[model samples]
Target chain A: MLLKKRKSKEDTALFRLEENEGEIVLWSENREVSRQLSMIDLQEEDLLVLQKLRPLVKENIEKIVAQFYKNLEKESSLTKIINDNSSIDRLSQTLTIHIEEMFTGVIDQAFFDKRSKIAQVHLHIGLQPKWYMCAFQDLLLSLISLFDETIENREDYNKAIKATTKILNIEQQLVLDAYQKQHDEIR
Target chain B: MLLKKRKSKEDTALFRLEENEGEIVLWSENREVSRQLSMIDLQEEDLLVLQKLRPLVKENIEKIVAQFYKNLEKESSLTKIINDNSSIDRLSQTLTIHIEEMFTGVIDQAFFDKRSKIAQVHLHIGLQPKWYMCAFQDLLLSLISLFDETIENREDYNKAIKATTKILNIEQQLVLDAYQKQHDEIR
Candidate 1:
């Protein structure tokens, strides 16, 4: 029975697409799309909160990104990875875009595709999850500090932090999901 | 400066090997292999604790593995994945071997290789981390229950549980590392 299923799967174009180089068609793309979002408990309200913070994020994004790399560069191994696989300038630009998009308050197909692309790129460069998680943790701290520094209302700041945490969780989930998919294919 | 580093990297065979299909030589392999072990803080004492549990684990692995699949089969989506991509019998056999190996309590290159292979196989089959994590969580609870039932000493049980958690964390780190390496290669 499994053999028959494998045979049918092999005969499909999608399977071939997976077999092709530099092309990824996620299995989830065929299933219920919102399942992952639901898994993270990201909702309309969370998106709204993020959307509300867009202007603030925009105001600090340049400073936030600059500070992110400045801190990242202090690690010697990561510095080599950045220098060899990519540059600080390039990473900073990409991260700026990534941060801006996080606050866009939309979870559409396009958003998933972009997130998947980021995950794929990070994976291709052999970025360990340890470093990735660390990098994001730093980014999160900076963002939270932004909230503390700027947001006047405690309640609103708390809500914003919650929303940001959920969004970041969603992002990490995408990266992990992508990593899992590729990890399977590696063998 | 970054361009010079990139150029030098591209000239290396390791870079070429990375670009080639079905060949993965992780960046970590060249560095201190024990780095990941240190990160998880899996020490000699923890290994000793797990070594002590080997006899009990050997006795109950069959039952634990059986219960694992029985619980996993309750998830309809996972069942479909199993039916389509692999057989319950094969997975059960591999998992039994994996569980047995965990108790052997040796952290060597061979052990790391086996764990990496397991991670790669799961990735190829498109297992989501959510299900992977849930399955392991279930497995961990069963292992804890085993300690509860068999170990008469509370201190012994507590030590065993902590060791088990560390071993599992080490296992997970291997899986995540493999995923990250492959994630980078997917592009």
Candidate 2:
């Protein structure tokens, strides 16, 4: 299931040399390339753990997104942000696919770019960072609960949780890094 | 200091009538009309009280808006929402005008519609109702403090606060009413 992403930009221009994880990287100074790196944080251990947990997360993704929205609506403060039912459903489907793709354990430049785009969409709609944090917390808790239900082995479950968390942490880092850059540029 | 607002919308479209606060209001069913109303809930006593306080609120408006944004930025959650320095300055000026117009005691159809539009802008940007409430609280406290400094009579100070509060309440009501309508439609 390793889908190769298209090389988005032709690397013709001069790029600054940088070191990444004991490897030499020629980084383009272009804003897009400047913000991205060749680093994909998933390790062999994380990948193996994630591969096992992927199916469980996939099956429960719908329920997780539903519960997330339920929590959001319960807070009267956030009710105003909900669009029509159809739009919510659409966003839910998109998020489910996003989660499924995330568990693929093939992090790449496209993945980082997609995370940046998500940050941009939130910022464009004036969504504050607190809401994103709230969402991430909900998603984290939901996935952990899913694992708690299906996983039998304590040792293996612990491994799964750690791997899932590592990927989640990387996802968050990508988003915040993009957010800070855009925030600084706008300011 | 009653600055008369130019009538921006022509009453060409047919509007349904609704009674509010014992007044016969020929309200249009238009989204703008459904969201707005004739009176902004400022009573005669409140208006008279607000008239006296208007000049002072006008004088300290800049300081008030600055203090509002300053408080918003202090909260780590909201810093990401702040645009560049110049954009913040521009919005502050717009908000200052909005606050001044609010106490005009002229809460006509135009005022109601304008309040609804402000609600739309906030909701469009995914700004939660809590932030609006927080802002109103800040504005309210700032204005009351300003009145306390200038007004000698305790009774007049109390009256000023009441008048300001009544208009502020009406402003929230208009925004929330519009927000609900939009939320329902989108749902």
Candidate 3:
């Protein structure tokens, strides 16, 4: 009889975020799973909502980038990644454009295509999924805090968060399925 | 009789992941809220997770940043802001760090401290939340996908997620109460 592989709790990983010039990166160790799931595709209404949020989202991205760099200058590991003033300046400009587009929205093809490319990149790098998720979660809290002042009705904001959480659950299922297949193959 | 000020969803703001350097950044228009939050003081466990995920998240941030720049390189309104490559690079790096930090762990005093800072930053910039919670939800999906790959057990992972979500709900309530107090003060 073939024995099925059992999953252990101790084997679980964590998620996190990272900073590169002006952009925020959600990093993870589970590249194969993330890639297999095709996670970034947005529904029609999701796109519409994102489009509506473009202006504020764009501005928020820029500010988050600026502040993050200012903080990183204080860290040693980051110094190796970011060398000088010129490098920082270029990063900020690139980040502004990036944030603008994220809020603008994307179609399914573009989203999936990007995810595939990202998967390829991760495979090349040999990083794991745990690190990425932890970093990304940190990034989410920062963004939420950034927008805290504008949240006039706490109830509505909470409801929006609930909606967001529902979507995340769906995405998680997709990612798990993808990871399982890959793990089995590796074994 | 005095009339109460009616709050509108239009007054709310949204946040998202923007690309800079080789990473992602959290962006939004609402400066006040962003300034109030901070992503710097992540827990040791969270930081460990983020460290592991850095590579994959960085690549995705770079991809998003590149696409954003490609689009902006054409538009007249954004050209002035993104004219220089150096600035773009700096911005990307900054954003990568911020994004890496955001998703690393559960929200706590450190998270709240960062949010307070972000809120202050937004106030200075004179921006507002635009996208509501859609972009945030997308960011969460990316993290979840990564998590699935690194974690070997489904039951343990689910338990962690449930615990985290409950904590977040509690945090949300505190945030709401604070907002109500602030609103009353403004009134």
Q: Evaluated with TM-score, which candidate comes out highest?
A: 1
lDDT of 3 by residue, B61-101 (tens): 66544543443343333345434323667656765666655
Q: Stretches of candidate 1 above 4 Å error?
A: A1-32, B1-127, B131-175, B178-187
Residue-by-residue lDDT tens digits, candidate 2, B26-130? 334454332222122235556555554567778888899888887676444344555622368678888888888765556457776787898787766666554
Candidates 2 and 3: which is better by lDDT? 2
DockQ of 2: 0.01
Q: Could you say which candidate leads in DockQ?
A: 1
- In model 2, the Cα lDDT at residue A137 comes to 51
lDDT of 1 by residue, B63-104 (tens): 999888876765678888888888989888888888987876
Fill in the DockQ of model 3.
Answer: 0.04
Reference-based TM-score, model 3? 0.34
- The ten-residue window of minimal lDDT in model 1 chain B covers B1-10
Interface CA RMSD, all predictions: 8.6, 18.2, 15.9
DockQ-based CAPRI category assigned to the predicted complex of candidate 1 = incorrect
Model 3 residue B42 distance off true place after TM-score fit, in angstroms: 4.4
Off by over 4 Å in 3: A1-44, A70-75, A82-86, A119-131, A159-187, B1-187
TM-score rank order: 1, 2, 3
